[model samples]
Target chain A: MTRIGRVWRKSVDGRTAALYLLPSIILFSVFVFYPMFRTIYLSFFLTDQTGNAAIMVGFENFVYLLGSSEFQNSMKATGLFVLYTVPITIILALFFALLANEKLKGIGFFRTMYSSTMGISVAASSVIWLFMFNPSIGMFNRLLGVLNLPQIQWLLDPEWALLSVSISTIWMNIGFSFLILLGGLQNIDEHLYESSRIDGAGYFYRLRRITLPMLSPTLFFIITISLINAFQTFGQIDILTKGGPSQSTNLIVYSIYREAFINYQFGTASAQAVILFLIILIVTILQFKLGERKVHYQ
Target chain B: MKKLLTSSLFWVLILAFAVLTACTNSDSKEKNEPTKNDTSSETEGTKDDGAATGEKVSIEFWHAMSGTGQESIDAIVKGFNESQDKYEVKAEFQGSYEESLTKLRGVGGTKDAPAITQVFEVGTKYMIDSGYIEPMQKFIDEDNYDLSQLEENILNYYRVDGELYSMPFNSSTPVMIYNKDAFKEAGLDPEKAPETFAEVIDAAAKLKTDEMYGFSMLTYGWFFEQLVATQGGLYVNEDNGRSGDATESLFNGPEGLNVFRFLDTMNKAGTFGNFGTNWDDIRSAFATGKVAMYMDSSAGVAGAINNAPFEVGVAYIPHADEVQRNGVVIGGASLWMSKGIAEEEQEAAWEFMKYMTTPEVQAKWHLDTGYFAINPAAYDEQNVKDKWAEFPQFKVTVDQLQDTIPGLATQGALISVFPESRQQIVTALEELYQGKDPQEVLDKAAEGTNRAMEIANKTKQ
Candidate 1:
């Protein structure tokens, strides 16, 4: 009788567990999985003005997108954007996280300041950065003028527009990276550093040997997140550069947006989206494969 | 302990995956949600109050106009609602022009679609080709309404294949507005504005100084479209896509090249300022004395006069010194009647559109906003005449429209993918601004736009 009761209780608990997971699973399916699969399916057909897939032009969109100069440029821009934003954000965030982890008197205030940017939405930050990047009346140019430096056309000159947009993105991302790294820093056992200090390890030596190795898991997490965020960067690029001064800042996401909504060429847009997915997927898999060796999980 | 560790690790993996998917999903989600407001509210509003008031027809009118434009629209709607007790007109501000059109197309064949919609001029071909618009001419023909009462030049733009698809509402034209005080200071006549590109260059050279640029315009395709029209050039093939469907763009021709060269030369000469494509920035630059001359929609005249501390002068858009100056295409939007609504509601919408375009109503709109009156008769109205004397800048647009020839070129490109073409032109213009060869950039842009047109054409088919 006791054995039957145990089995019954286990069955009831399993039912409850399934019920608890239902909402998230449903949401993940509807909002995430459904749209993604739809994007891939719609890649095989041309969509009309109302975004309903109408024409069955199988593989034509993919062929067109792969051969197109515009899509090729967008891929290159997306790559450059990722390269520009990711490492800089990770390093600065690590530096700030280390500083904020200290038990100094004003450390709490500095930590708050470092993570404050997490509160600002991409729209708000992009608008703020846009004003700062304006060529004639912006703060950066005023400072340049004071130093007798020539004023740079931040958003207009094709060479500099992408870099200008990346500056804003890096600023927007630093806070999220800092908060994660800070959590990682605080979780490290205090005795690890104490043992390192007793072993005649200086600050640089300890950072290299202990802090980095101990923080590798968090560092790995941060790197992966930052890379994904960099690939998906859209709002700042949309507002600041508008993918131009000659499509110099036309990242993959922005290209997808322009194609899907602006031009309403959903087939081509979906094809491009599928390519973006493949690119990101391959990149992440490669990161896990190559980067897992260095990430010492404690 | 191992069980707990592994269980927690499994959940963490799920959480990480959820966050990753959610992050990417958020971008398209936020960008797309504004265009999908439930149309259920539209039908209920009619039944709730509309039926209670003795079976009154409640017609929804969706518009993109907001801020000052909304206020004007609200006034007109109120006027129409009060002017008759049989029909109740409900006006809603959907979003930007693009958003409103997207929403309209989304509900294209549905009863929830508004009885009347304000579509921008570029949306003309798309609206007609969608097969969801009840041609305004159908109503005019049914009622035996006199179409000749409308301004021929403004009416010319909305007419295609010998029938009007929509009613011309708020119309403006591209015009050059200069700081008259600055022009005088620079030893150029404030009264005599530059009528040709060469003259503008000459004037701009003198007006530019160490502290200020002489000219600045938003890097927009509308201005390029105007430049194309000023040379009496078609923007698309097949008679500017009026006689037959345009399969390709005509914007890569020598006329487009000349316009590019003119702007590029002005840019290189240090006389023209490049303000990236924000109207507010360009307007503020002119207002703050950073630039002496600017070209914008004629509707910008009111904003200039209100904001600028100096005198603002309005002039006709400049032509190439060599090319004969053909007049400009109309700017701004029009009112289109939806096909799926009730016949009573459709008739009511038609009545409201006609009322809105009358001399008194159009004049009121023209005075409140800087947009040109759709009816030329509005200019002769006593109130409009008085306001014209007070601010003579309003007369320039009227004269420009009056002088315009409603031929194929000046009738404007009526292709479905005009907005896409505009975007492509901006890209080419930016490339030109960055010192790329105009021929290369425009040719490439034209190729892309032609492809967009082909796709649009195929979709329509």
Candidate 2:
């Protein structure tokens, strides 16, 4: 009887625990999960002006999206954006993090400066970069002029618009990655470095053998975030370029914005958004799968 | 375990409190009412014994004006609120034209939108087609408001099939803005601005000096629209500027080619500062006096007149040698009344609408914003006349509109997919600016535009 009573109490405790998690689960379902499901569901249907009633159009939106040259160009641009931003942001963040992590004078100031950019919103940073990149009166061209080089259309030339946007993203995004790397660097044991030094290991050899392997987990984290962010790039394009210099600066989200808001193609835009979400999801999963093998918990 | 439980309980209580607060806030806050944050809300329930009133009628007006515009709108709303105690009108600034549209659209339900909203000229078709806007003629006829004083051209942009959907608030057309300092630097008299296409080209060539271009024009589709309109050409075949059909893309003609050729010529002559990506860039370039002359919206005058480092001279946009000067269509926003408001609120809205269109209000708006007075009588007002004379550049837009032809193309076509089509045109222009042949670019653009139009037509009811 006592055992049965204990079992009943345990069952009650389990229910209580579920009750504790119920609100968050409900919120997650309502806000995040439901919207995600709705996004996927709406992607397959043609919605009316009010977005309430929809006509069942199986795969037509996807087909149309696939056939669209604009969509194709946007996909290509997004791919290039990912390629440019990921390596550049990670490398630049690492460089700053390494420099800031050094046991030198004013290291705290350098650390603060490196991480300060994380506080600026992407929209605000884009506006600041727009001023900085103004072709006629920008600081960039003035510096170029001082070097006696010809002025270049940073955001106006289709060939350079993607790269230009990438640079702004780099400057705006590096701080967050830097913080992650700095955390990873701080986790490395000083004893290992001391032992390596006592055993006649040089700085470069120790770094390659110990630091990189130890930091792989953080690198993986940054890579995942950078890739996701690069794919979801919208603010810089919307604020700085507005997909201009002849549609060369357009990314996935900007095209989605144009489709849903400006063009009122809600269904098509939803389809595009779903496609992007899936791509990000697949890439992220792949990253975790690959990164899990390299991430030494110890 | 006790600490964990306490913290968990604390968070749960906090979340519950937040959710409850949000719910109450939303419920008390009237949804879809235009003047949600109106002054009437703050005034509380005060019974004025002027007319029959149980619960006081309050109407919401969402506009994109702050600063002077906000102050003026507030004064007008205050006047309406005080003049009669039966109804209270509230005016709220809802950020930019794009932002207002986005907000209105985001709150999709009928009960969540503002009673009245200010949409830009390009969005007239989109707003009307969305079936949210109530035709102004209904409010005018129902309430017996004076309608005869409204100008025809000003009203024409808001009409679809002879039915008015909105009232013109701040109407402006494109005109040439020149820096007098830059003009003098180029050894040209600032007073003698170029009046013809040939002269503009010649002046531009002569004005090209160290790091300065004689002329720069925004290469957006609006410029092409204005160019085509000025040359006595139509952008759309039927429905003029108000068509629901999307499969009828027609900007690949001689006139469209001419626009490209002209831009190409400018580019080759180093007359453009490579700032044709957007309107702000063009304005900022002209403001800095790096470009001697710029063809942009006259509404942009307020920004330049107040912010430009040098004095600005406004003039009519130069026309082709054969065609005479014709006015460009207005580029500013208009006010639309949304559905789902109470009869009392609608009446209050009409009263506010009439107040906005009155000569005194419109004239004040024009003088302050560099937009044209929608009421022709506003021009006759002594205050408006004084401002016009004080800044001679303000007269250029008014004078240009006096000779407007309102050709099928010049009327500014309103289609469901015009914004997309405009992008297509810009894409083509970009290609042309990159040295591609005008004919080829137009043809390709027309093809792409036709495809977009097909999609729009398929979706249209």
Candidate 3:
């Protein structure tokens, strides 16, 4: 009787565990897992009706996407954006985090101000940036003119368009990364820094040997988040430049939107999206692998 | 103690599961609800009052007109509401033309659907063929509504296969809008605008200064339509713009080459300014006086006049001298009635539609908005004639349309995928405008458009 009761209790526990886990498993299957698989399924076929998949095209979309100049330029733009934004955002966020974390007067207020950019919508920020970059009446050009420097077409010129977008993106995103870094900064062991100071380690020496190594995990987190955000840059381009003057600012995600919605090439757009997903997946895996060597958990 | 810890761990897991399940259920509901609404709206046609209890039948009318246009539409609706208490007509402004179409298509069921919608010419084919729109011919036949009072050409635009699907409220065609100040500054007569393409180019070159462009036209399929029509060539060989069984395209012919060559020349002559790759940008550039001579929809006149910081002179679009006369395609939205409404609601809709198209209402709409009155009788009315005296250029759009040669090209095709096809043509034009060989650009555009047409035609099949 005792053995039977124990067996019944074990089964009941198992049942409870399964019941508890069911919702999340179903949700993941519905939203993330299902869509990823559906996209892969869709990538193999072309659109027949508006959103329906017809006969299987079998890798034709991928081949065509690889050959298109638009896709090529989009990849290049996305690559440049990620390159420009990831390192700068991480470095600047760390600096801001360190500065705000210091025991100084009005430090909390300063910290709040530093992270305030997280509240501003990307659309509003892009509009403000457009005004600031306006050549004839913009503040940036006016300041340049006053300083007797050549005025740049920050949004107009193709060469500077991507750079301008990157600048706005960095400003918009720095807050999230700074907050992440600040959280990590607050978690650090203060005794380690105290011992370093007692041992006559200078600020730079301590920062280089202790602070950076200790903050590696946080930096890694920042890089991962920033890279993902960089690849998905759409709102700024959509609201501001619209991938112009002459497709100079056409990023991958924006091109995906244009292809799917504007051009109504759902099949090709899906293939582009799949390609974007694969690239991000590979880069994220590689980033994680690389991060393992540098990130210090202890 | 170990047992307590284990039990607490289990409780934590359960709590997380509860939160996750709640989120998952809520999100699924959110995603599925909108799609359901969309499907229902497409079928029901705003039957929120599904239970008819002999109460006054209220009908919804969604439109995109705002400001002066909005005020005029509101006045017409108010007058209709007051004219009879039998039906209550509620009019709502639903964003821009594009956004209105999207919203109308997105919602499906009684809570949000409008009984009548003002669909633009670009969306005419899509709405007409979507099986959701009620044929205006049916409404006319049922109610014995007379469409003969409407202008023939304007009425023809809303007709599909000799049957009307929509009624034109206000129609407009592209006309030359030149700056009188810039014209006088360039030592040319502001009253006499450019009459030929060559003259336009010359005037534009003469007017070219450090701050201004000579000429700028919004690059789209419509531009090609006007350009091809100007040179007496059809864009598609199909009847009524349907390209079914069509073997060849007319755009890559001589007319196309001439149009593109003209653009390439203007591009090289520094007569064309940095026109953005879209209609709004092109229009804004022209309106701001950055471009001396602008060509756009005559319907855009009111907005242009109200917003433009300088005097704008409207004139006939310059054509090739070889062509008989200036021909411009009509551009504006028309009221499309969708299917699935009750007889009473449909009658109410027709009443509102008829009221909108009446000479008096149309004249008020046109005069207030600068869009051409679609009713020929409106022009005969003393109000329109009197208003024309103050702004004589308003008559140019009508005069230009009076002599228009209607066919597949100039009549504007009602293809299901016309917008996609237009994009291809625009893309080719953009390539040409950027200095590609004219013939090469023409050939490329023709090829791309034909390929897209083949795909689009398949959808029709």
Task: Return the top candidate by lDDT.
Answer: 1
Q: Extract clashing residue pairs from model 2.
A: B32-B111, B32-B112, B32-B113, B34-B60, B34-B114, B34-B115, B35-B60, B241-B413, B241-B414
Candidate 1 C-alpha lDDT tens digits along A96-151: 99999999998889999999999999989999988888776788988998999988
Q: Which residue runs does candidate 3 get wrong by more than 4 Å?
A: A1-14, A33-38, A54-56, A106-112, A132-160, B1-53, B65-75, B103-113, B219-221, B243-249, B278-288, B380-387
lDDT of 3 at A20: 100
lDDT of 1 by residue, B179-257 (tens): 9999889999999999898898889899999868877778899999998898998898999998888998888898898
TM-score for candidate 1, please give it.
0.91
> With candidate 3 superimposed using the best TM-score fit, by how many Å does residue B82's alpha carbon deviate from the native?
3.4
Worst 10 residues of 2 chain A by lDDT: A47-56
lDDT (10s digit) by residue, model 2, range A83-163: 989998899899888788789988999899999899998878899998888887789988999999998888888888889
Q: Which portions of model 1 miss their true places by more than 4 Å? A: A1-25, A198-200, B1-53, B381-383
Model 3 lDDT per residue over A12-37, tens place: 97889989999987976775666656
What is candidate 3's DockQ?
0.27
Note the residue pairs that clash in candidate 3.
B37-B108, B38-B108, B40-B108, B40-B109, B41-B108, B41-B109, B42-B108, B134-B338
Error of 1 at B160 (Å): 1.4
